[model samples]
Target: MVQRLLLAGMLSGLIVALFAFSYARVYAEPNIERAIALEEGGDHHHEEAEQGTVSRDTQRNAGLLTGLVAYCAALGGLLAIGLAFLHGRLSVRPRSAVWTLTVAGYVSLVLVPQLKYPANPPGVGSAETIGTRTEMYFIMLLASAISMAVSLWISHRMARRAGAAPSIAAGLAVFTALASLLMTMMPAISETPYDFPRALLFEFRFHAALLQLVVWGGLGVLFGQAAEYMEQSGLRVEGTARRGIPNA
Candidate 1:
């Protein structure tokens, strides 16, 4: 059963990857191209820069596709494992639980950290600080995930005594407090050039966030449906076995 869930997750990830890739290709790629042009100062220079390395065409097409597929697929697998662990634990239905986890995961893992350090286009940041920037982002991500877990645990504990509404409120309160503290403790990172176009920058960031939304939202819905189907099928099988009608 666990293995089946994992397979479903990976498949769902792949399906979402296609949607994500299509969105990026249509909406995000142009912004990236513009950023590259801005960084290189013109098309001529950009072409020269790309002579020995991978071409932008390849990067935007096959490269982008491959990256999204691998990323979403892995995320799907993790989602399955999470669903399995949370199964029979949450009081809500399976679909609700999956979606709730998805929302929480996105808020903690992506949205909060992004507020502190939004993703810059390819040519925006310095090469020297790339390592430092990555490390900081991961630190923020980890802190947010941990805080969310703690908050959920608190909510679960409270739910038994206080009921759902109060428990949820308490969870939200704790999460906000923890998230605020963590954001404050982390050093700020702003690498965008002053000359960079504000409109373009905002557009790129918006698309990036939207792309993530598509991935997580798609996974949540798709996997939730898959889980429901699996559950119903299992029940049917169990019923058949009980009736000694499995010969068919």
Candidate 2:
């Protein structure tokens, strides 16, 4: 089980890393160049001077690829642990677990706080306020995660009495109301320049959300398949042992 999980995690990480590298190269890198141009007062010489010894190729390829792969690998390992723990606890089969984990990943990690505090491109925000903004974002993230967990618990408890459909509706209502209220209550951070292109900003955010979806969705599918295979293999070995079969 452990070996299967680790292998799945590595493969998922590799896939996510490749996807991110491509997306960053095409979508993110151009915005970064534009931001640097803006920061350099649109002076080509100044932009060239400000760039340190680190080559653009190295930054785009080696740095980005290494960091992304490492980060995704860590995320995959954590996800594997989560899937293992959730096994049998959620009364879900391997396939259903994939759906559950994918939804939870998007809701808890991306959707909730993203609506409240969307991702920004380079040179969009105040450096002085970065600490405060980060703190606020994390607080909102924790709140969102807790709200989802509590809502699910409430739904499970209510299911015993009110039944599954009613309980799900009630839980979803609670989640929606609470999440909306929290979003309203949370402090807003608006740092985009007044003249910044709205279309570009929209594109950046769209790609960012898509990136999260790819990683989480990929992890769920690959990990679930590997786990199911492991389970099936274990059952086969157990059955063979029960039949007093000799090794081939």
- TM-score for all predictions? 0.97, 0.88
lDDT of 1 at 76: 88
Give the winner by lDDT: 1
Q: Residues 33-148, candidate 1: write the lDDT tens digits.
A: 99999999999999999999999999999999999999999988988899889888886676787788789999999999999999899788899999999999999999999999
- Model 2 lDDT on a 0 to 1 scale: 0.79
Candidate 1 local lDDT, residue 17: 98
True-structure RMSD, every candidate: 1.1, 2.3
**Candidate 1 backbone overlaps, count:** 0
lDDT of 2 by residue, 101-216 (tens): 66876797689999999998776889999999999999999998888888888988998899989998988998888899899999999989998878878877887788777777
The TM-score leader among the candidates is 1
Count of clashes, each model: 0, 0
Please list the C-alpha lDDT of all candidates, in the order they appear: 0.93, 0.79
